[model samples]
Target chain A: MSDPAGVIAIGWPQLLLATGFMVVTGGITLALQLGVTKALWLGTLRTYLQLLALGLVLGWVFRLRQPLLVLAIIGVMTAVAAQTVVRRAPDAPRGSYVRAWAAMGLPALVITFAVTGLIVRVEPWYLPRYVIPIAGMVIGNSMNGVALALERTFADMDARENEILALTALGASPWEAARESVRTALRAGMIPSINTLSTVGIVFIPGMMAGQVLAGADPLVAAPYQIVVMLMVATADVLGSTLVVLLTFRRRFTPDGVFLEKGWRPHAR
Target chain B: MDVSGPSGSGKTTLLRTLARLMPGATGSLAVDGQRADTLAPQRWRALVALLPQKPAILPGDLRTNLVLPWRLKVERDVAEPGSEALLSALDEVGLGGLPLDRDATRLSVGQQARVALLRVVLTGPRVLLLDEPDAALDPESSSALAQALVRIAATGTAIVRVRHRESDGLAARRLVLTQGGRLTEAGP
Candidate 1:
């Protein structure tokens, strides 16, 4: 399976070998009559097609090496990530999609640029190979952070309605009333990244590191890249969650500082 | 002043409205010749505090709960009461035995109700909105609470209390909320 570059080339036959794992999973689902076999197979097919399309597109972008094209792809990725966040946090207040876009896009793009341009010092700042993948990781992690923070914020708003009202009655502003909920939501959002940072190598080799190793990179050389990725992820998570929380907490109250009742919808814009 | 009505009547809603804690509520409110709309919501609420029927005990010790209002940025200018004043006020409200360091959540509902009342009262609002402040208290504790309200009223703070029990002789005037959601004077 080794190519001339000494890296294992995953051709159709090797992919068929990987498909066997899914077949085993499908068989287990069938044996248990788990109803999800149909969904599982559909998901598997979708994953294969989507990744194949992504690879072709990325290959084209890499060959061209145009900065604008790379940025366009990142913009599309951010839009999709924003939509995913909104879907994941269905109970979040209306207009949360816009906030999620800003929260996720701002930190992910900024940190990715900093990592590539300043830290990794990619020869050309807009190098597609470095920028696209780093931006994807940052945006993906940031999307999760924004979604978790938004969902936890709404849940806390419902659960802590009385506490918030109590604070307001004592002359606390909207921000003051929502302070505790924001803190908890930010913690919920950042905990996954923190856990990954703490247990990256000990518990599991992350996908990026594993991919580098499988590509014939030395394990010791690949370790530093994974460290940067993990730290960048944690930074993106905190910054995105903080922005989301700050923006969304005010929605829990009216302009007059009254806490909105559960299921209260915003005025049609 | 005291407001009384049947359980389904909107006494709580009325107090919340007075405190501007209702978004849909529309009316003009004035405090000491200053229009409410002119003041910031935080400042308006500071001048007119509401003590809800269900007390909200925060996650902290008794002292923290009592001084919660003072800790707010809006209340930065307001001086927090000293421990002696807090202890004496607690004694006045029939919660003297409770220590300052006691876990607030561990207190009984009646005790928490008193703490809620004390929290608003200590802020020294010009107008106090109390919703069934003594509903959970024993008769003795109820009397102490009534006496404390009277003393607070003496300091020129207008008191609007929603009560279900017979009058404790504190209200200068009493009003009843009819089922039609109208407030009418109740015969003394």
Candidate 2:
């Protein structure tokens, strides 16, 4: 049982390839969004430096083998990222978006460690690779889902504030006034993942299954894991999005259900 | 009912409070015999849309803005109003046959207000709370705005004017924001 993974050889090549992929992804996103070459270079490089620093920190921590520590790191990352993204959305209330992210991230992380731990106990409960990746997969998707959910819900409230007023006119309570936007926003947030499910293994080869196969695992062995991973991601995203929308709806509006423009930012799309 | 009084009487605050932004507000003012403080104001607003001091226009066509409220789940029956309807509403408000696809913000102040007022008409808010409206208008534009308010009021939508200056030509009940941050009724 010889391991090809070596501090002994082939180090810079792997590192270079990973760096290349990272640059390409960030470059494409920035180019499409902002369309400035210098901006893309600087933005992507910033992202590269940030991820590298984080990876260096996580690498040492993971080697320490405390599952609880791994869970905490992921939890904090999700919470902070969620706060950052939602806080920047246009028209968001001052502190509500950041608070909502923490609220969503806390529950999602608890579920991450608890439910993932319960299911992952196939004799050795602390498979760092699986636990970490699966947690990342679930929580990362949840982070995006929550962000979109908050952004859209707030936007919907702003754009359709009259309907909210109408609902209020029809004797709907403040919570009831936001019901439509919340539903539409939640549904909107789930669409990408739902579409991904429909196109799974067909439109593209998913990375998880491909990675397992490359590591010499059977396709059958990888298939169930991939399927479970996809499902969990969808579940976590939906749960996190739904909770964020609901709690956020309560905090986002005036008691009369007027959309508080200060609570969340706007999505350009 | 015409109310004309001094400046800084907090007329805007009255509208905002009426909208339920002050959930923990302990004081009370009744609107048509119901406590405005406790009544669910969103519902109140559907029947009555307040045109804020400066209702911002998003970067979109006039038709889109007019009909946006109808698409909300709460407004299942009100279809997105067509461009012709929006244009017609605008026309009724003295902005005859303006471009519906024009960028709203790029419109002149008077033009934008007409479009917004048309939006209220098409969207069907029964009460119009206008804040310092027509401050930027030329005399002709202000006169037209005055006429539009009269016509809208005739349709039974109560119009409340919070004005900083008199003779914007709105012949309606006016609430003056006093220097002491209170509303005292006055007549022209």
What is the iRMSD in Å for candidate 1? 1.0
Model 2 over residues A55-144: C-alpha lDDT tens digits?
787687767777677767776767676766576455555566566666567666665656556765533455565566766777766666
**What TM-score against the true fold does each predicted structure earn?**
0.95, 0.59
lDDT by residue for model 2 (B122-152), tens: 5555556666567777878878888877777
On the 0 to 100 scale, the lDDT of residue A234 in model 2 is 81
lDDT of 1 at A180: 87
- Residue A183's lDDT within candidate 1 is 89
Superposed model 2: Cα runs more than 4 Å off: A1-10, A13-59, A122-127, A255-258, A261-269, B2-27, B30-188
The 10 consecutive residues of candidate 2 chain B with the worst lDDT sum are: B71-80
> Candidate 1 residues B1-188, lDDT tens each?
89999877889989999899987888899989999999898988999999888789998999999999988988444589989999998998889878899999999888888899999999899999998888899888788888888889898999999999987777888999988678766755
So what's the TM-score on candidate 1? 0.95
Candidate 2, residue A36: the lDDT equals 68
Error of 2 at B29 (Å): 1.9
Q: Give the CAPRI rating of model 2.
A: incorrect
